[model samples]
Target: MDDHVSQAVGRPDLVRLDERLICLRFETMKVLSADAAVAHLLSTGAVRRGDTLLDSSSGIYAYALALACHRHGLRCHIVGSTTVDAAVRTQLAVLGAHLEQMPPSADLKLDQNRRVARIRALLAQDPRLHWMRQYHDEVHHLGYRSVARTVAAELGNQALTLVGGVGSGASTGALAGYLRRDAPGTRLVGVQPFGSVTFGSEHVSDPEIIIAGIGSSIPFGNVVHSRYDVVHWTGFAAALSGSVDLLRRHAVFAGLSTGAAYLAARWERRRDPGRTVVVIAADTGHRYVDTVFARHDEALPIESLAPHEVTGTDGPALPWSRTEWAGAPAPPAARVSPEDTVAPVTR
Candidate 1:
């Protein structure tokens, strides 16, 4: 039995969608990272029980961090992004997490930037508050070690391809990083929503929402560019189709990011039938009920869609575009100097 609900929630279910495809579904994916991060901080004397943990999250991480703080006898204060819905806000409140939500903004970039600025202000005001830099810190990578072991145990020594959103790079990057220790040839495919500066799709904006929790407007320090073998930038419409199809075909009701990953994973599975492809479904579809599932009628057929292959980030961002990142460095526009990296809070 687990000590806390967060431990149970952190565990992922490995569902085989087909012979060469697997769906890694999580109730709240960030719970794994949050638990590990808080534990590490406590062990290193960086934070103590009852110390308020501060961070910015769109939705998932806010809930994950709150659960972690609750499990560890700590307090949580989240500067929520505009995408945070009422369901998440209520849970955060019940979990005793203090949430400061940003005003509505059509641009998610502005929403993210404002949240970071607010976090900085909060940190400056309260020395007791430890800023959990979920977007930038390496500690978030610690939790995926067990997950990698689980995947490795299940799949043996076969060539594998991991498909998931880059997000803060903790989920896909860290899992791949740990998996590569044994299977060095493991292929990592990153999915991104249009307009995320993390992979240089910022020039072209998605007509719909940016698909929160999967992409970023700013550079996340933990995102190691060389980790990905391929990158796919998918717009909201394509993802919606993928989500609807995934539910109809596989009964895997997941979020928009999962839909995008599923779309990318299907293509990867077809291109390389020898390698097993694993898709990361970071969260469930509850929050997306109104925004995504309700618009199922508008979803295009998944079979009719294919990514426009591109050689470089400079190419036009189509509804779906694929590029061979092949261990490339960060694009010039998204690169940051060593000093620009955000350091972990220590007291």
Candidate 2:
């Protein structure tokens, strides 16, 4: 029998929305990362058959890890954030993955901190458990190489602009790096929520901003700031509006992060009508039916801002920002078993 699920994880649809804009729908992008991480550990003998894989996630990564563990015949454990919903909880259970969800907190930073703390406690309890540091570890970047190669092969030698939400930085940053190797003129545009601190945006306490799976309140080591040519801090209203517009216009049922990317792609298209803009659609909209779709009418009207229209005073300067970390070295690889002598995986 064919392993359809394993085969389907990384091969998402590359769709063309218009002459200038395209969408890379990675509904199972995290699954690809999890598979690569697990495969690396196995190939390096970092883990044995009976060992357990562990990690901290908001939602998608946990589900991905669970699926990966199931395929590899390993146990899985997750320290999930408060944002994890009932559906995800059920999926984890079905996958035979243990989950410990953090208590509800309005602040995402606090939630992440608590999840990390819990993961540490869990790690202390078991020597056989391996932590897959999705946020900081570079191994996660290996999973996106195929996606980048696919983009390069499909659009050969074209001046391209890659747009997506910058989370752990693994997905967008890694893809940008790979694509640029073949097409050096490829521009990278990272989209972040208004309240996120990832791209040096001012921190605001807005419970109303419910967009997850994209922006982060804390720093992510995988995010390479220098790889980005432009950054856009999208507000909740703008993201919600974009999500709605995607459903209405393109019939693309995507999540808030996808909406933010779509909005940024539109701006990019307007900025340079000649360049081909590709947006990464990370996930679908089924998980957001109640919070996003049900509350669509309440979304505030957003006047699309041109690249120059965005002012720096509110956050980082529009189009460009002084956010690059000077002389920042690459983060150390995740600790592996002493006996495991394999070199770190690279794209």
Candidate 3:
């Protein structure tokens, strides 16, 4: 953890904070959603030089909207969920963004309404507030598509056997579009919470995926309608533990959603060992300190993932798959040159 993260979460670093490679995705995968928000804010004339703008989103959306509003000299008021990390909240707040808490309501336990209601309350109090409805808006796709393009570019002709997530349908949808063009060999995969009706299933699965920011009770046209190849299910605790172990071993700090993708990736890899599997670790694990880092995470009742070596599995409708690499093996110590050096060892 960085000093800022330590201060934000108000904990002395007993263990050094390690940020793992975590599949940077690519430079292109970076900065999804902000550009669109900026353009929309200007084009819609939804904000003025000194007016306050209202945004309802999780971490990524909040960060993007705050940046857009800030650039235009408009104050942004963001209402975020408790599931959002303290570090993310702190960063946005430090950027001069005002944050309002979203209390969990009886009917809105998993519904994003508590935050929406807060934003609505802010708007009710002031007419100058422009609400950026990200859930239904197409502009949000701008950034999401960018991420998808980046993911596709990262594949670089390699076969992508699986891809999927629950929340922010825009991100997954855009990736679907990009993969459809660039990585033609790529396969699409999606996951949903067991009872989620939006992803097109109401049959409450035995062990529903519990990662926050993914899975919904409502059907999302943006996600469900995409050209998906397959859909699978995972338990929350299982995915959570998987993410934690990923951090501990691979030194990869991924958010729960990313972990879910990893679980899917492993499942796909099992169907074919030679296939190149790409996992989209959408967000960092710093957002999950409350749970993974702690002996316990109170955010959700789901279980964390467990460590297991990747092994091939046989099945008809495997999570996902593609053809193996076609070639031969170079035996015993192929020529080595000084130019074929590892990273510069200063020591």
Candidate 4:
């Protein structure tokens, strides 16, 4: 990658189309100390001294929460899937948080439910254990709300179409809330992996997704009367194609969620006879380097990208199977150009 363009892409200045993407990059320009996460938890009553907090998270949030618990003199333990990367596990251990892993293979429903069940069992066994369940935690909901405020503020000067993925529905839901309160007219749209039942609907889907990351089978976010305008669905292949397009065009590397939202945003620009659609690139794709975008022989195969599992329905693949995601079929990839896939034209 050209260092000059790579450094400049984050500026949100060089990019073209849809009123320039704005992000909550306070941590990008400067590192946010653990104090920030700690303060947010303490002030929200989410954490207390001598409390034993147990939580499940993807690596990043787990790392952040562990740090916060450490700072507040709390005993923290985490339950992570065995699929958690080895490196992430090391980091969690280094952070001084006790770790436990989930069982081997099961349908994602079985996998995740088993993990949650384990957490619930552990919580039941120990009265001192405080489950830091983001699903129900208002403060957990607040993390994305704070970021949404930044997105709203940045776009204050122009009309906006908002985009992002739903993991536990917190981020997108919170952003929708903040936008409604602040930018009442801004359109808030969410992107979900096609098979993810997160905000169940048959509209705007791509192919397949399991991803263990964003997008949930269940709806998240309290509806303060229709906070979100629409939830666009994206398939895994489309998301991968989108992620590749972002790298080629905008010089931004982000995860599949980024790819999913990126394509949705471009679709908004293409389909919506409107101006200024803004999508969140969430985080750079550095972590995904080893997974989705890895070398052909080493990375997950394309067949995984396509839907694989069928539930009780009489169909090849589950008819709109919302239970779990089997990756998508990989296409014989070629040059990621604007003609092949849509992306910012700035490059």
Candidate 5:
């Protein structure tokens, strides 16, 4: 029934996981933004068929942009992070997208920096190429309008709370922005990994990983700090337990970021039983099988895990922490001029 595979992949399934909690699951979440961005660019004459689109991605967005390019008859050139796995690389290759993956690095900041540097270099060499600034551009936010409508229609007038990873500010941020237009009381809770600079948790590093794709080491221009009503900073161990428990209890196989969001969602629902909490599962568990699911035995009991409540960024500590964001401005580390979110002209 769809014109392109991207349409099917980008469409999410809303599944009720509990009496007051639901899961908004996606195949490859970035496909929604990629397809919409490409379509808008074509309509506005910023790009055309056979032209190349360039962007930097860690993993999810690379495959997403590749699919969008395939569907739209455009070329995709991805400056990928070291986190991009072999499976994603193969998919990108098969889809005819060009990938320049960075060398392996454990430090996320270095990996992100390397990808951005490569993108800049590529843009300098080819002014004809359009950069899909997934982390910086507001155009990416345009895609979630329909998704918000879907949520509003399906959930139907209950006091709503949306919980998801604050990735690039396009998914969770955009959805909350759209959902709030009609229902002004809709609450937005952002999930972050311990080391993400986006929400000022960078001071405390998670020993395992930052739950990649959910959190960022560098500041993302698209992240509007004021949108969040609450923020949860989760570590690798806590998120792993959440993912393992989610599969065991709810039969939902989702990624690391989803686990973090699920953990936060459960807590929020417990505190506010009257509100319906929707957790965003951005992708499936396939990519995280070896890293997270395989370590299921190491997962702790979810009932035993509770976040350390903090009033401010400095108070966040340990495996999990929660803070009342309460419409605060961007933290000092992530403060960027509003214009940074604007898409730049092709260099």
Candidate 6:
């Protein structure tokens, strides 16, 4: 009997939304990543029974890690984002995972910084706690190898393009890496929010931006710039409109990130009309009922722009920058060095 929680992950439904576009709904994708990471640690003897697994997350990864800890008999602690909804909080409680949520901030970047500071303090107090660095660790990338294989098996030798939010870079990057080996002609497109620092977009914090589970203000070590053939920077209005369109058009209720990916995939399909375009739907719309669906009428009127050829990694001009990395290397991991002397936070 395969009673493991990891068994409950992956094998997402691939629904054809258009003649050229398909939505790969990975509602429990993070579970596969979390479970795989935890299983690797356990098998490698890096973590033992009663050891507390700690990490910072916006929501999905937190839930995934908590479930993994429950299965492995390990303690779980999460430094959650301020925007984490009640649904996630309730689930964490049910799983017996301790959650320390950061205070409401102006933007995701500030929220993430506070969460990191909190994690560092907790790590200092208890050296036995294992910090699962999901943002920077290579082990997290291993979880998506199966996903790529599934995609390859389904598509065969068809020329495919994969689109999804950049985030920690594990899902999209790992998927791209695996697919390159399976199908060398596959193209990768990464989506990011307007104010995200990941793709070198405007660094200013926008409180209006509500898209979560993707994009980052701090440097993401996991994101391999070269893996992306193009990058899209979608704003709140664009993402909101995309989400509404998905719900209204396809009856596919998914999170804001999925909406953004759908928009990109639709644009790509319209542009080529011959290639098969696949978008990753990271999560469901259950957690985003209030912010996404409730305010659907308020979204800006979307204007589908024509897809342009990308030349280099610096990205396209203005608006939605889409550019090639030209084989640029990923940034260094943001780790605590010996010279780092920041004070620990008590609150």
RMSD values for the candidates in order, in angstroms, are 1.1, 5.0, 14.8, 12.4, 1.3, 4.1
Give the lDDT of residue 273 in candidate 1.
97
Error of model 6, residue 57, in angstroms: 0.6
Instruction: Extract clashing residue pairs from model 1.
Output: none
Instruction: In model 3, state the lDDT of residue 124.
Output: 64
Q: List the residue pairs that clash in candidate 2.
A: none
What tens-digit string does per-residue lDDT give for candidate 6 at 1-347?
56875566544778888886888897767888888889998988888877889999999999999989989899999999998779889999999999999988866778988988898888889877888888877789888888888887877888899999988889988888999996888888888876666766644344477467778877766778878877777766677788888888899988888888877888776767778999999888888788778999976544654334455434443234455554555434322243332222211
Lowest lDDT 10-residue stretch of candidate 5: 338-347
Which ranges of candidate 1 are over 4 A from the true structure?
Answer: 337-340
TM-scores, each model vs. reference: 0.98, 0.87, 0.67, 0.71, 0.98, 0.89
Better of 4 and 6 by TM-score: 6
State the lDDT of candidate 3 residue by residue for 1-347, as single tens digits.
43222122211111112221124332222234554555665766554477766666656667666666656677777788665567668878888998775665323235464665576667667756666656545556665555555555554665665455746566665656666676665666665443444443344343423455565543333443435555555555656655766666567776666656766666666566666665666666665666655633422322332223212111212111221211112111222233322211111
163-251 per-residue lDDT for model 5 (tens digits) = 99998999999999999999999999999988888889888977888778888887888898899999999989999999999999999
Question: Which TM-score value belongs to model 2?
Answer: 0.87
Instruction: List per-prediction Cα lDDT, in the order shown.
Output: 0.92, 0.76, 0.52, 0.53, 0.91, 0.78
lDDT of 1 by residue, 1-347 (tens): 98899999999999999999999999989999999999999999999997999999999999999999999999999999988899999999999999999999998889988998898888778767888989788999999999999999998998999999999999999999999999999999999998888888999888877888888888788899999999999999999999999999999999999999999999999999999999999999998899899999999998999999998686847699999999999987677666446664567
Q: What is the lDDT of residue 90 in candidate 3?
A: 84
Runs in model 2 deviating more than 4 A are 1-4, 299-347
